[model samples]
Target: MNSLEKQVESAWKNVDQQKDTLISEHSHHLQNSVDEELRTLLQSVRQLLDDDGQQLEKDVDKLQLIAQQFREGVEMWQQKAQSSVKAIEEKQRVLSLLVEDVSVRTEGRRESLIQRQQQRVADTEDNCFRVLQGISS
Candidate 1:
């Protein structure tokens, strides 16, 4: 080859090497950017999962507390009902005793009234007999 052709060939080789180097550098930068983006995406997904899991746990705890409160309220109501029933039974027993006492007192008063009336009737009969005898004589 002549000198001019040799110089042109050497220039072409230099341009090819520079092109390859630029391509390799661009590929490396692209790979690093993709890796960084993937890491960010994975971290975001993990955070979301953790937040959802914690919220689920809180909801479950609230449900359990509500259930326990419901159970305690029911138990308290049952206890109140039992106490009311016992009080009512006691009142009923007292009322029954009062009725019996009143009945006995009323019976005693009736017997006393009857005895007094019988005594009055006997005295009237004796007076009438004495008056008839005196008139006949």
Candidate 2:
């Protein structure tokens, strides 16, 4: 009877150890599953951030291209405007020179006409004095 009791006690101790081992294994598996899920979530978030960064870079590149085109357009317009202004200035200068030449020619013609009129008046007066002298003789 004492031997039977001893065997029963030994069996009970073995069962308790096996139960502890099983509980430990289950806890470890649950922890591994939670860690795997956390890792997957972190990877997905990283991928999303990478995609957003790439799109941002593309947007910046487009804006830079547009700005460069705008600057070029402005430069072209400025060049054309300057060319037009220069052309107008040249035309004005040529017109002013022509006006000056015409004024000088007109003034010379007027002076010559005045001199001729004065000579004609003197000649007529001399002819009349001779006629009066002839009548008196």
Candidate 3:
């Protein structure tokens, strides 16, 4: 039982480590991507402002496209992060419930075994007493 508990604890620890690594790696990647997109957007907007006539409309369109792409990318990353968090939270909840259930069952079984052993002891003592009385009589 102690070994089982230790195994469970070790498994949870491993899961936690993996979750942390995944979260950090994804978050860093998302942050870098967002930063890069922002930089490009800023550059595009500056170019639009600096450029002279005729192709001014094209520059404006390009800036708008860049902004739109950045918005979509950020939104996508936000959704992914939210989903990942929700999944991890659900798993954690399940693990907690499982641990609680196992602990309760183990305690119940231990108590039952202890009661049975105590009863056996009491019964043996009573039998011994009866045998001694019969011999004395």
TM-score of each: 0.59, 0.53, 0.58
Candidates ranked by lDDT: 3, 1, 2
Instruction: Kindly list the per-residue Cα lDDT of model 1 for residues 10-70, writing each as its tens digit.
Output: 7556755875576567656755765576567556655675668877666556655665675
Off by over 4 Å in 1: 1-52
What's the TM for model 2? 0.53
Compute the lDDT of residue 89 as modeled in candidate 2.
56
Candidate with the larger TM-score of 1 and 2: 1
RMSD of every prediction: 45.5, 46.2, 5.8
lDDT tens string, model 3, 63-110? Answer: 678777877887787678768876977787688769878888999999
Query: Which number leads on TM-score?
Result: 1
lDDT of 2: 0.65
Error of 1 at 80 (Å): 1.0
